[model samples]
Target: MKMIKTAFCLGLVWGASAYADPELHFVDLQEFNAALDAIEAGESPLSAMESYVAQASPVFQAYAQRYETSAASIADAYSERPGYYRSLPELEGYIRLREPEIVSALSRLEAMAPAGEVVPTYFMVADQRAGGTPVLAAGAAGPQINIAVAVDMIALTAETDMSEFPGGTGGRAEASDLPQVVIHENAHVLQLAAQGGLEAYRSIYSPEGGNMLAVAVREGCAEYLTYLASGWRLGDRHVYGEANERALWSEFEAVMDAPPFSVPGWFSGRHPDHADWPAQIGYWMGFRICEYHHQSAADSDAAVRDLFTLYRPDDLRPLAEAYGASLSAN
Candidate 1:
C-alpha cells in the first residue's frame, strides 16, 4: 500500500502546548500524477483514471461527476491536447516544491475559519481545460472539496512570453501562488457549507428569485474571505492594479441599484468589451461590501461568521450601500 502523506503545519508553540494543526489529504495528487505519467508513456489513461475515481470518497466522486464531464471525454481532451500532458511533470514538480508552504497556508486558513466550517475531504486532480484558475466543487452530501488543477495552463502562464497562448492575459498566474488559489477556493467551500449545502445554493438561482446581486454577494464574500484567510488581496491579483479598482468601484457605485438582470454584462464578465475592465469586477465589488460589513461590526469574528451566512441579495445590498457611503465620507 502506498503511504498517503498528510500535510501538517506546526502551530504556534506556547511553552510546549502547541495548537492542533489542520490536516489536508493529498492522496489524489499521487494517484492523479500516476495517471498523467501513464498517458505520457503512451498508455491509455482511462484505466488509471477510472481506478482513481472508483477509489475516491463518495463525496469526492459526486463532486467530480458534478463539475467534470465524463472521464472518457476528459481522457480524449488530454489526448488531443498533447501539450497538457507534456506539462504534467513541471506541474507535479511545482506542487512538490511548494508542499510545505501550501500545507502551512492551509493550516493558517483552517485556524482562521469558524469552528465546524472547514471542509475535511480535499481532492486535487488534473484537468487540462481549467486554465490557471482551479475549479472547486463542493459535495452536496459531505464536507468535501474537489479541485482540478490545469497543468498546461499553469505552464503556459509560467512562460515569460505568452504571445502564443490563447486567453494568455486571463490565464496568467504564478505557480508559486497556488497556495493562495487553494485558499480562495477553500473560502468558497466554507461559503457553500454556510448556505445550507449546494441544493439551497442552487435554489437561489430560480428565475424569479435570481439576481445579479446574488452572484456578486456569493463571489464577493469568497473573494473577501480569501484575503482574510491568506492576506492576499484580490485587488492586487491579475491585471487589476490599484487604479483599476478605484475606477471600477466608482463605476459600480454609480449604478449599483440598477437591476442586476438589466445589466448582465456589468455584473458578470460575459461581455467582450469587458476585456478592458478588470477581470471579475463583481468579485471586487462584493469584497468591498463584505469589508465594510466587517469593519462596521462590533465583533469582527462574529461579523465574518454572519457574512458567510448571507445568501440573499437583499441582505447584501445594504452592506454594499454602506460601503458606498463610507467611500463618499472618505
Candidate 2:
C-alpha cells in the first residue's frame, strides 16, 4: 500500500487541484502496441519490452514498478506464449474499437463518484493478477491514486487460448466487459480514498491478519457498487452464488473468519472444498452482506457511502451476522 514512485512519459506532477474531472489515459496501450510492432520488425523482445515500460503512462509505469517483473522475465513470458502474444494485434484493435463505448461507461461513473473526487484511470498492457487494479503513481508534486486496467487481458474472452501462458487465465474478460471492470476498480480506489489512502486501507483490511471478512467486504462493496453504477453484475460468481445461496452461505459462514491462506479457495482463486463450487465465492458472500446491509438500512444512500467510510472488519461483523440470522430464520 506504500506509494510507489514511477517515471512517467510526461513530467507533469500529480496535483488534484489542477484537474476539473477524472482523467483517462490510453498511452500505455499505444506504447505496448509500438513494442509489438518493434518485436515484429526483428527487434529483440527484451529491448522492445523495456522500451514499452520506459514509455508507458504514469499509472501503468507505476503498475510495472510495483507488480511486474524484469523485462527478461516478460520477454520469456512472451516467448513461451507466442500464441497469446500473436493475438495481441487483434486484441488491441478490438479494444480500440470499443474505446468510445468504454469512455461513455466511464463517464457514467463520474456522476456516481464522491463529490470533487478525481480517480484517474489508465488503460494499459501489463502483466497483472487481475484485469484492473488500484495503483499509486507519484511525481514531484505528490502521490496520485489511479486505476490501471490491463486492456490486453480484459480483451480476452472464454475462448481465448491461455494454456501456454505462465498464469492460467482465471479471470478472462471480453472487451465489452471493460466498463464494469473499470468501474469496479474505480470503486476500489474510492474505498482507499475514503479511509485516507491505500496504506491506511491496508492497515485495517489485511488477509495476513486473518481478517478475511474485511477483505471480502472490501471486494464485495466494490462489486456491489459496480452493479449500482452499471447494471451489470461483476461476474458469473453472483449467478452461481444466487443459485446456491443457502448452501454457499452455510460453507462460507464457517471460514469467512478463518485465515484465508489456510483455506486457499475463498479468495485465492483455488478450487473450493466442494468440487462443485467456483473459486472466489467469498466475493458473493461479501456482496450478499453489503447488499443486505444496503437493503435493510433506513438510508440506502448512507449505507452505500458507509461501505467506503467504514474501516473495521468488526464494522461489517454485525451485517454478516444479521444476514446469517435472517438466513437461519428462513
- For 11-130, candidate 1 gives per-residue lDDT tens digits of 211111222344445565566677777766767767756765666554345445444644675566555555544454555566667667666666666565553233333434545434
Quick one: best TM-score, which candidate? 2
| TM-scores of the models, in the order given | 0.70, 0.84
Per-residue alpha-carbon lDDT of candidate 2 for residues 85-131, written as tens digits (9 for 90 to 100): 65654554665675565556555654565532546677876554456
lDDT of each: 0.54, 0.67
RMSD of 2: 4.1
Least well predicted 10-residue stretch by lDDT in candidate 2:
1-10
Q: State each candidate's clash count.
A: 0, 0
Model 2 residue runs over 4 Å out of place are 1-18, 89-116, 139-141, 162-168, 198-202, 205-210, 260-262
| Predicted model with the maximum lDDT | 2
Report lDDT (Cα) of residue 323, candidate 2.
Answer: 87
